[model samples]
Target: MKEVLLVGFGAVGALCTLTSKSLSRSGIARVTAVARSNYGIVRGKYSLCLTTRRSRVCNTVASAADQAYDYVVVTTKAVPELRLTPEILSPLLSPEYTNKFAQPTYLLLQNGLNVEKDLYNAIRKLNQGKPSIVCAALYVGTNLAAPNVVVTNDLVNHFSQRESLFLGIYRHEDHTTSANSADETALLQDLGSIFQRGGSAITIVPEIQRVKFAKNFWNLSFATFATLTGYTVPSLFRSPPASKDEQCNPYLYPITAELVQQHSIPAIKTTMKELLNRDPDNSHVPSMLLDARRSQPMEVEVIVGEVHIDMLYALLLVKQNQILGRMMAQ
Candidate 1:
């Protein structure tokens, strides 16, 4: 069985832990969980209920890594305080005496566009290389219901019980490998088994940047608007549309007024189409929006800022094609 080491015991970490338990039950993998809040390892056969399992809790990274792991999954938030730096993660990658672990795979289950890039640079800066890198875009949601317990939102209650949760590797200009590669194919198959065990669906795709950007379009637009307006997703939809007098009021910022006027919403919609080749109708509550409502620091720069540049580029391309009469009329 593959030995898995999970970092960050937050929402995503909790989900991964549960998934690990399912995997362990199937005899496909064994997992040890490490978190800043605590170092707790829970081991059980597949039949164990995640909520009932007691984690072998600890508080330090060094203490958690008494032995090496065959696969290391990092699920911490992108913020530096909770993030695992290369220095902290390096020892787990170490090949030393009494450590049976060899080059272990690294799976990053973080959000935003630069998750892999930041980790890659960090690993490179430390002169560490060996384990294959895999980037994943998690389309599941989890809530920290208790101090050590993470609650998984029933997807059926959220996404109309959609069978497949999208997972893929975000490809940049320099990285040319497709998700169809041997590593990804095998990983996808393994993930498929895990998802199936959880009664969920899995779709593995390459060109993850396109999906990431598409996801960002939904995450940022709602997040920026909601943060500025202090409205929840459901509440925003319930807000009455501004009348002309309210739209033209000089007291309101013109840009803000325009957004409220709904004139720019179509442009935002078009931007989503241009970036992801699809509209935003399928999107659920964006993480940033959730964070904003909870009074947490939002990833404005990472999610919105990074994708905003790309959105503008796409906008420019759209405009240019229209001027040249080369537009793809929808």
Candidate 2:
């Protein structure tokens, strides 16, 4: 059986754990989860009701790495500025684990640009074989909720009975790119098989980076603006157009049109398009906005700081500096 280590078991991780459970039942995979309550720093709680599961759950990454895991699926937020991903997984990358067991494939479920770089570099430095890294772009809304519980906000599609997942093997290039190696190709298929067995709608893409960059635009624009202005995605679509009266105006801030038209629109056109597509009533709070309000660290370094465009680079850097700088002071 494929031994899997889950680094985080929040909403996204729980949704994925269901699949891990399926893989376990089929004897395709076995899972060990690091299930602490966001290391006691986070306050959001999961809200899912599930049958009592029997998988091994540990309180920390060091304990969870007891066995040589075949796959380490990280669903934690990519906040390298606070704590680098490699630093978090140092125990797994340590000589003790590397010498004892086979190198594990990394399945990164975290959002942001080039989120796999740190872990990738760590494995590369080991000079073992090629690093097997799987990156996913998911279309699911989740909240950081109670321990061991997931707030299942209608993530599963009743029509298909599966959640959408876009998968790709990562290849980091400074200035050039190359084809996936034979081994990497096979590994990608193997991961696809694991998720497929769990009834996930998986689409293996050739250039996952492009898809990731496209997704980042939404964060750079909608997520950033919502975070800056303290509003939710749904506020952009309030009734009868935003007006002077605060009641009719949907935004927490009065400058609804000014926010959308002037800044967020240019950065990305995704938020309004999504609103036009699936009209949902649940609180569509941007994750970044929640982080800011809670006085927690945000993913500005990856989502904002990693933009390739020089034009946006300076702007994002300034914005992230202001946000993180304030946090540091506090």
Candidate 3:
């Protein structure tokens, strides 16, 4: 049985535990979670509730010292300010514990473009052994209902909406290639199977970089607007005002799809033309807006800001190339 260790016991992490447990029933995998703060609450008994209203207690661990795991899944948020190396991975990948645990496969289930690069580099710097890195772009809608309880939406609906877990190997040398090794391919297939058995739809893709870029494109277009305007997706789709008083009210005047198409769509389309695009059926509350509402720092730098920076750099490069072309012609 493959021993799995899950870091970040939030909504995604808990949902993974439930799926991993289902895999355990088939004698394929055994799952354990590393609880950083909620160790006490998670260790004894914690429940996961599905959209169907089914609930079950999940398994968790305080640490990974006792056993070696074959896989480590990270479901943490990808924020620029957070140093995950020391805060999360050090305990497992440190020099002293390197020998104790096997060089496990690292599955990063975080959003944003190039989110896996830093963590992958940090793990490589360990020099213990090369751990196979799998980058997963998750589309699962989940939330923590309580300290020890996680609730997830229906998998059927999630899949119907074309929301799936996209997985691929992380290789810095080439972002366009598929899994280079047979082992990596097998592992990915196995993971896909496990997730499928657990009821989550998953796809192993070749062009993960493009996939990340596409995901970020949507995020940047919708999330940035929602974050800046403090409006949800549904709010953005709210009907326009009929009367002058309604027109004057800020709350009534939503930045609707018509507005976006008229004013923002052209720029958005131009900006994301190269990436070529990649949603949910739920009430369209962007995560950034949720973070802002909760007074938590949004992932502005990693998600929206990074895209802006890349676009600026691309424009600069294009301008430089044009100048050189003109000079050569002259």
Top candidate on lDDT is 2
Off by over 4 Å in 2: 18-27, 38-54, 155-163, 174-182, 238-282, 308-330
User: Taking the tens digit of each residue's C-alpha lDDT, what string does model 1 give over 68-96?
Assistant: 55567777766442334465576664555
The global C-alpha lDDT for each of the candidates, from Candidate 1 onward, is: 0.55, 0.69, 0.62
lDDT of 2: 0.69
TM-score of each candidate? Answer: 0.65, 0.75, 0.71
Clashing pairs in 2: 45-145, 45-146, 46-145, 46-146, 48-150
Looking at candidate 2, what is the lDDT of residue 197? Answer: 77
**RMSD in angstroms, all models?**
11.8, 7.4, 11.6
Superior candidate under lDDT, 2 versus 3: 2
- Give the local distance difference test score of model 1: 0.55
Report how far residue 276 has shifted in candidate 2, in Å.
9.3
Best by TM-score: 2
